[model samples]
Target: MQRQSIPALTMALGSTIVLALLGGCTSVTPPAEPVDVVISGGTVYDGSGGEPYLGDVAMRGDRIVYVGPQRDLAARRTIDARGMIVAPGFIDPHTHAEVFLNSPDPEQRVNAAWLAQGVSTVMIGVDGGGSPDIAQAADRLETGGIGTNAVPFVGFGAVRSRVMGEEDRTPSGAELAAMKELVAQAMCDGGRGFSTGLFYAPQSFAETGEVIEIAREAAIRGGIYDTHQRDESSYSIGLLASVAEVIRIGRETGMPVHIAHIKALGVDVQGQAPAVIAMVEKARAQGIEVTADQYPWLASGTSLEASLLPPWALDGGNDALRLRLAQPDERARMKADMAENLRRRGGASAMLLTSPDLAWTGKTLAQMADLQGGNAVDTALAIIARSLEHGGGQTNVASFNMAHSDVDLFMRQPWVVTASDGSNGHPRMYATYPEKYDAYVLDRRTIDLGNFIRQSTGKVADIYGIEERGYLKSGYFADVLVFDPGGYAPRADYLNPRELATGVTALFVNGALAVENSNPTGTTAGRVLLRPAPANCQVRPR
Candidate 1:
């Protein structure tokens, strides 16, 4: 014993075990297989809404090849993931990552903020804000270099803006056909589907029939329709009716419908989450596929003009709106309309100005108005005017319109997945996933860890028909994460809006280490994902 080395001791112990078991141990123990990377000794949440089990995950190239209990898996690189949670890297189904990834700045292209929170794939062109030129977009992202995988939606806003130039009227036959062609081409070129922000301008001008037709094009091409519904409150058709409209689109088009940032917003419809859930459930029962994504925030972020102005007022673009705001008769109508809109949004106190241009990034509309020596409406009008002068409609506001109860209720729905709807000025852009985990799973116990991972990863992938990703299944793409259980949290808040989140210990994108020790490895290993061409263009008959 004094002369025996550790290896000799181990060999003697193994021989004794083998002799005791009569070769049972030898028969059961498989030979070690070498892999590119091995993540060992972690509690694995498979991202299938199931219970977690202690296991090791091994990757070869860009694919996961093993997911089971402690295997003798030899690897080029091994991650000692003891006392950590190994999960599928989160898929952000809604994010404005394009705004940064496409920017000339290389620093923002890494998207370290999202990477630090364990996001491996980001869905862009959400809320009707993507390009119709899918091929060109893919080229742009590839040329610019991206940190997280990017999937795109052909934005309804872009499509309409291209063809109609913000016209308030219905498209002509030629324009409609042109729009449909653009959408079809986009789908064929790898666009996930047609994304419409009907709540915003231009797309808002399109009627139900127009949306149905446009959505049908994507549907026929095996694409899903993702929408920021026409109304989430009393802005136009109301929240309940907007839900019904989305259901109608799905039912009529025979396409899957996914509501982006689904919520019952404002004081007027604060408690309508149940109604929305009922509608989606009923549609699902009737053989319609309907799903939704929501960020874990009580307030919804949007432009000041988009949230308050009537769609008609935004017709003919910002120039026309500014002209109207200058006319006394027009201003009266706008004021009257905005007052009701503000009321629907739970009044001035419920809105927070989030634009960095103004000196009120974290202050409520009422407080900002008081400081500026005016009522909330006048203050808003002035800000919008000033924002227009800057040659871009970038007046962002964090509308504290949703109730916590409604948010919690929506979070409990099975069909509801997680998304950021992330934009520049909002905290949700950088903090959504971690915020959801910290507040909902860790702190509140509202949702368990397994289901949380499922909603944030697999469920989103499944809903979008994203193949070879999302779940931590063997043979799947190895987009994975390892994180400390106690250390997972978001650092980005409304005041420090652009700060990156913390707590992700490591993230692997396509078998490459993209984030290590809660920091980006400066590795731009992401690829652009595209939809496959549809087998048939046949849609259900009207």
Candidate 2:
């Protein structure tokens, strides 16, 4: 059949419509097409650092089909989100989430701790613990199922340990080459970046040049460099110097530098937030991309051994440490060192043991020391020895080291996004989002609600280059949240750290309703988010 001209087709169709109208035959109205879900009458934040607006956001399947003012679109389910905040689901850039994310039990894997905080996505394998075998890790996550999206990185600690095994020595030329290959391989296997906890040992032994060389692999492959800088206080190179090192890494490697849990930690660095912020801004102006994530809390949680012991003591693993603790001269040397370190972190009373299922869980170090009729250092060493003798686990403590003013200063920075740094037996894992909202947004008014939401959502995604998952926009993934203002607040504190946050009324992961009416629907709708591998290399199949 020949195609009709536009005028001819229009004339014929117009005549037919005219005849039908004349006969009153074009009278029946067609029904509105139903979309999968319509979220109506909410104060939408949109995650763009914009003012809140009353609007509706519509989702269909795994992507958003519409997001704007309502226009009578039909829907299978309409969520009346009146008086609630509709925003993109939060992205936690730094988290030790693998504790729950890698669990075999579906319930633990659901990650209710973060789920109730309105988080739809979490970056796992953080703090220099990310897997080099990212492909296999992703495969396991997808196969076993999860409730929140997970991204992976190739860790400096993991790679170095694989090559050196805590030898406290620089890598040989061949060893360094081997480590670089592992980084490149991991990047090709879809790692988003290279992460280092230079503050932690084994990795601490790696100097600036070593880090630059190792991280350069990730840089050339288009991945960022994330680090928990070598020191946040006057511990080693000093906080300011450590920050400079992070910047130097970026300037040299040509990769963006991200500081994890940026803070002015401990009594020694109590008022250094402004200086740290200035350093980051200066670096950014110099064309080195720098960003950081912070949890809204006063106390910083870390293992007691990490906080007190020297890296040299941790050189040959727990066995060597046990030997050191037993030697008279070595033990005396460690005691003096620990005492000085104790002074660096406030005093014994400033450290509260928080590791779960332990006899010393709730007491402050000072109290424990008093009970044992010993000095803080001796008491601490005793605990470490017992812990090592039994199972070689870390004696974790919450150091009340950060000043409120310092925390406030860091929180106000635009480049600093929100993260949980969520550790076991810590309230931050479950309540960081709500805590920020309740304490910073609602009470202190340190940041307005829209800025808070933007920092938690789109800002983080922008910093990390997350594809299509951090905005309530058309064609983006349907990772969204609806929460009641009155109900959304932190339920956990140091005294009761594992309590789940309250008031995420509706949560969607990839457009699936993972939580409805503030209850989980038992759906593991998460996916393994991977960056595209380098074009020169084929990604290892998972």
Candidate 3:
């Protein structure tokens, strides 16, 4: 073969470079690559914690093929996203979306509340309520066709309760061993980690030492220790001590520690967010992995039982509590304790009924007491008694114990990402991202729009170790959304807590359009997200 002339070679190389650049402003699939969907001409927030840019995102199947300047690529669908903010679909680090995910109704299982809020993924099995049967749960989620992706954490309380019934005592050697085995099995079966609601009973019964021991199994299997903590208020060891306990747990186990819905709960702990932030930063500085999630709400929801009853009194579940309430002296003792708890939660007027009893759903505890012609304590006891008689879990309240200042302080922290400790009877279940964006980002400018998106998207995915789904980058999964900033705000409020949020123009889960024209397309494109199995993971024992 004859060698080409220098001018011919230079021209050929120049043409190749021009073609590469024309593929898109960034490295992308060739122009010949088929794009299933093209979201064009939008302000793109790539979830990189960076400034927004005007760009296009092309999707093919379940993956993003390109993200760059306007491309003249052919696509099956084209969305004119002009005047909208196009970003990675938000990832919620903590949520009780299980209520929807586990619903027998297919519509409920579609998880529209979260999908409407632009959430592509949610962490379920939160607050120590996860099942150890991770495989079974994953199978159900996949086969049932959910509306948003889910990550499951094997719960410490779930295993502990199964191994040892609801008792306020130390676990025997065999029981402890059994619980550890369950944690190992769950982790091996693809659970995220060991989660805890140590403030709740049976779980509360286990000492921190016991928890550290059980959580080590998760650590060994490369799982993070996610907790609702042992205390978030002046209950038990107090808030600061609780933070320290989590830090120590992380340090001791050599695992990451995530404080679920980290906050200064109750009057005694109000205005303590700064200190908590400092503690977490210090731990992080020490090379201990410590991250936290926070909801934007001033009120935290819980059952009357979880809020007012003492952990000891809650021992052995509602049956034991029923027996205790049946005894006059025991009832008197419980009332005294509950009265203090009510005060700690900022008085009876601050507790708003949220569910079950329609007649009293919107009333405060004080209002209910006044109408019932009884003191707050007596009214609370009566409600608890009635719930127990009806097989329990009938009462829930939104306790307005957090201060705006504290919430703001927590939100401003770099490590504190957005999450909804979402549950039934709370507006957060339907609208947390919009609420934060509307009130915190747009109104107060507490953090800029970029910060809000980062906190809600990449930051959460990074913290949870979810691979390849939080950013609109080349080769990432196509979990993307388009929203109108002017209209993306929460519809749900304290009084009307179930309304779906508005202003999501389009949402795609795994490259399938789940929402179009701000309406659900009724596509169940969600999957059970799983990380790579830990190298140390062992087969679960039979």
Error of model 1, residue 374, in angstroms: 1.0
Candidate 2: regions farther than 4 A off: 1-32
In order of listing, the candidates' clash counts read: 0, 0, 0
Model 1, 1-542: lDDT tens per residue? 02234344224323432232232211223225789998987777778865566678899989998876777778999899876789999999999888778878887888887898899999999889889988888888988899999999999999999999988998999999999998988888888989999988888888999998888888888899999999998878989999999999999999999999989888778899888898899999999999999999988898889888887898899889989989999998998888888988888988888887567778888998999899888888888888889895568888887887888889999999999988878889888988998788755667766677899899999999899899988789999999876677788887778778877888999989999888889888888988766665322221
Q: Cα RMSD for candidate 1?
A: 7.8
What range of 10 consecutive residues in model 2 has the weakest lDDT sum? 21-30
- lDDT (C-alpha) at residue 194 in model 1: 90
TM-score of 3: 0.94
The TM-score of predicted model 1 comes to 0.92
Candidate 3 C-alpha lDDT tens digits along 424-459: 888999889999987887566687777888998998
All candidates in order of lDDT, best leading: 3, 2, 1
- TM-score list, all predictions: 0.92, 0.93, 0.94
The residue pairs that clash in candidate 1, if any, are none
Which has the better TM-score: candidate 1, or candidate 2?
Answer: 2
lDDT of candidates 1 onward, in order: 0.85, 0.86, 0.87
